[model samples]
Target: MTTASTERTARTFETIGVIGLGTMGAGIAEVFARNGFTVVGVELTEEAVERGREHLAHSTGRAVSRGKMSEEQQAEILGRIGFATDLSALADADFVVEAVVESLEVKKDLFRRLDDIVRPDAILATNTSSLPVTEIATANTRPGRVVGVHFFNPAPVQNLVEIVRTVVAEPAVLADVEGLLGRVGKNPVVCGDKAGFIANTLLFGYLNHAVSMYEGRYATREDIDAAMRFGCGYPMGPLALLDLIGLDTAYEILETMYRQGRDRLHAPAPILKQMVTAGLLGRKSGRGFYTYERADSPVVVADDRTPSTDDLPELRHDIRTVGVVGTGTMAAGIVEVFAKSGYDVLYVGRSQDKVEGVRAAIARNFDKQIQRGRATEEQKTEVLGRLSGTMSLDDLARVEIVVEAIAEDLAIKTTLFENLDEICKPGTILATTTSSLPIISLATVTSRPQDVIGMHFFNPAPIMKLVEVVSTVATDDAVAETVRALCAKVGKVAVSCGDRAGFIVNALLFPYLNDAVKMLEAHYATADDIDTAMKQGCALPMGPFELLDVVGNDVSLAIQRELYLEFREPGFAPAPLLEHLVTAGYLGRKTQRGFRDYSAR
Candidate 1:
């Protein structure tokens, strides 16, 4: 299985057989037919065959309507696919792929039958994403020809296909399959017949962690989703993707992985089993983590049970004024966020020049937005007009709330909080945007400990939708609610939590990045290859190294150190390679010398 082939005979599959006609199977059939390979799709009965035919028709019709293919092309494509109620129609197929349910017994039974039906030299493949391919191959007499060709969802569009081979698999068999898939414009990667293969082993573990977090009520679903999307730039939140994947399917995948690997991370959340037992099978059942407009529609209906402040007092007092400290990019972004939300913003800087610089940076951001057609000139002017800067701390006395977005240093923030304790008026809310430092420490410095809370905003606050509202042990619940409401007023999703290092996002994210760095340090794969594996294999918006570069290795190292210091977990320890890179002043995109070269940009 580990052998690499230099000489390979080209294999041709004039007819490909696909078992099961559900969404995944039908999509696979469509892919083969569209690529000019004759596809024979088999179902249990004529009714099942009709359903498969209808699915193929609907998908191809969508392709034609989207101008991805012509009507004539669709007809020609459809002409290549034939549906059958019996498996006998696949007797002449050169290759057979099983895409049925993820049950091991069901797959073994089908492979036993296919072993007797197909030609002696024909190749048999299973599309199982989690199960051990070697075990599946054991069902057949000729295990050398059995392989796993795992295709991503919507096989026609996604370019990646993980080809899994067992120890007994002949290198020639993989060479043939690779050539065939590559000829059809698919990116083929070969790996051992391990559980979860390459992608799901990494992806499903992270997803299961998200599910476990939700099950523990660590954060609201919306906030968890927004934090990843806004903070890490994932295309979809983990819960949303799980819903799309179907909770039942995810549960099965996790179960198989946990059983094979015996790792705690692969364990499925208990809530998943409960939901599946209740028949809440995600989009297929019209309800899972979220409610959809229909069983198959992509539109998510607004949930009526969204988190609200009904428990807190009715503090509906409109926030008319806000203040932000520091002259860094986050500080300037905070000023822009408040100003754009129709609040008069007071920006406090270290000096007059720095105050002027913050105001200039805020104005230039608006100007860029206007140039990009994202905002009108009048809108930019109004937003900029709402912002005012000053060098004195007393200037924030009249503001309803003062959000401290200064350096991540604890001493600097504690000193600022002490000043705010003296300078601000009574009943004013003081919030800190410290990423890792304890909010309680800052609260202790203030005379009004109940008033200080953590309101952490991601980079470029105006664009990111997530705002974590942290409440210290002494902080008032009403103050936390008020801060949450203020986040809503500014069009942000606020997740409430007790003060802790890394909060929710960084706590979960940095460990994964550190794992990737460890993988690189071990030479398991090159940085570029690991990044590609994550991007294409797991569907992340950016690979770990890519994100590390943009996030600044120096910043990541600090966060990792804080998490390690607080948790004292060996897993949270910063990678030596990461620390070395930071020590070398390779501070990511800022220095243009992180994992990947960005100086060219």
Candidate 2:
């Protein structure tokens, strides 16, 4: 039965009809034409048609200048695309894709009109990013032949295309569309006909949460964006990406998803609507979260929100000698960072052997840097000269600041803070490198709460550039400012935020990973397809599943649980699949079995 159906619907699509001649539509037409399909591009008027023609010419002309294409090939590609202002032009087309405005009524009207003009067996598709594909299919008589073919922006360049299938869609139609997209050099992922599909569903939820963080004054816009870019390795921060996507368009997508799923995570932050109403659409309008040089320009100009150099804060306490606790990798890295920056470092460990082991680790790292030509032998000697190790906590009494990189238990950290408070001087800054634990708990444990802060550094601290500067309610502004300046002195980008669970990076990242798990738990899409949608469609460095597996399902679950407990938001709860995996001891690479088995490797 499958073979017979495949043979019957194996019709080759020769001519493709594209409705709407906007940036996305023209790019779609170019993609099909470049792949040798005859394309009929239809707009509402001749002027619109001419604009689309110019768009194609300009795009291809740039390719020629960049040596990516020849002039003759560009001409041939353009010649295959014929523009028209009437629906009758698509009468003989075998496939039709409507890339019209994101209005449901407009798309339904276009699909209804095309039903009479195209052949009876022709396949119709919508390029919607957030609307209901099943409802749009119901607008035409042959709903089984209609599907959603969503292309990411800049269709010609992006490799991802989402093929959304409604319950009534024929298997043959889906197979054909997937094969066609493959031929056009696109990586297609199939999913159910739902608002936001896969990429936008996960992507917008994160973007909305970032906006809410900004609205609540949890962090400055620059700090929030910098944390994601430097910590998570994302190509762009959420707020900046929202600006490029146009705040108005983002609001619309969020509104549609919220209306459909009723998930509070998808609800547009209140500030988004206010910005859209005030015409702060984003780069297109020269203003949104940031101001641009002009409309449609990428160059960011100075605005009232820009930080001024003249208003910089002065370092409160004169920090010369630094002290760190623990013998773990993070502790060693922190010790290396301080010593390399010309500060005398005194690190304490459980025993003399452990203290010497930290020094050996630093020597190994400096040796590797020398081999890579990133450091000099003389420089390594100078850095090592500044390091001192001891087995007694009393030695930290003379240091100006004590940064605890110890175990992540509150009892252990608070006990250490209490010891340091008694040993160290009155003005010594007591800092903790805890990522998820509350900094205030440790601050309150110390005698001088004003001197305690969080200097949370990323792993391989000698490499990663981000350091989250967290301040508790009792922490003095001078202490936070001094830590921020010290971070700069050591060549780290510092982002300040309130002392809270998950801080900045974990707060935004873990929930998205949890959502991906939920999507898999519901059998909405396979893990591989979800990963591909994010990596290709959203340009993220790694998919949520890949990151979760590397970060350990147990670790991710713990962080997610913390976030849920702190905010009490239902969406922040950890997925049951993740909990089950952790319970089964499928920790991650550490155990050789996680989201995917790696035992063979």
lDDT for each of the candidates? 0.85, 0.93
RMSD of 1: 4.3
lDDT of 2 at 326: 92
TM-score of each candidate structure, all chains considered together: 0.85, 0.97
Report the alpha-carbon TM-score of model 2 versus the true structure. 0.97
Q: Write the per-residue lDDT of candidate 2 for residues 1-601, one digit (tens) a residue.
A: 3454434646699999999989999999999999999999999999999999988998889889999999999999999999899999999999999999999999998888888999999999999999999989999999999999999989999999999999999999999999999999999999997789999999999999999999999998999999999999999999999999999999999999999999999999999999999999999999999999999999888899888988665678899999999989999999999999999999999998999999999999989999999999999999999999999999999999999999888899988988998999989999999999999998888789999999999998999999999999999999999999999999999999998889999999989899999998988888899999999999999988888889999888889999999999999988999999999999888899999899998
Candidate 1 residue lDDT tens string, 556-596: 99999998999786656899999999999998999989887
Worst 10 residues of 1 by lDDT: 308-317
* Candidate 1, lDDT over the whole model: 0.85
Best by TM-score: 2
* Residue ranges of candidate 1 with Cα displaced over 4 Å: 1-10, 43-50, 64-71, 82-92, 109-121, 138-145, 165-175, 189-192, 230-235, 291-304, 307-320, 370-387, 514-539, 564-587, 597-601
Best by lDDT: 2
For model 2, which pairs clash? none
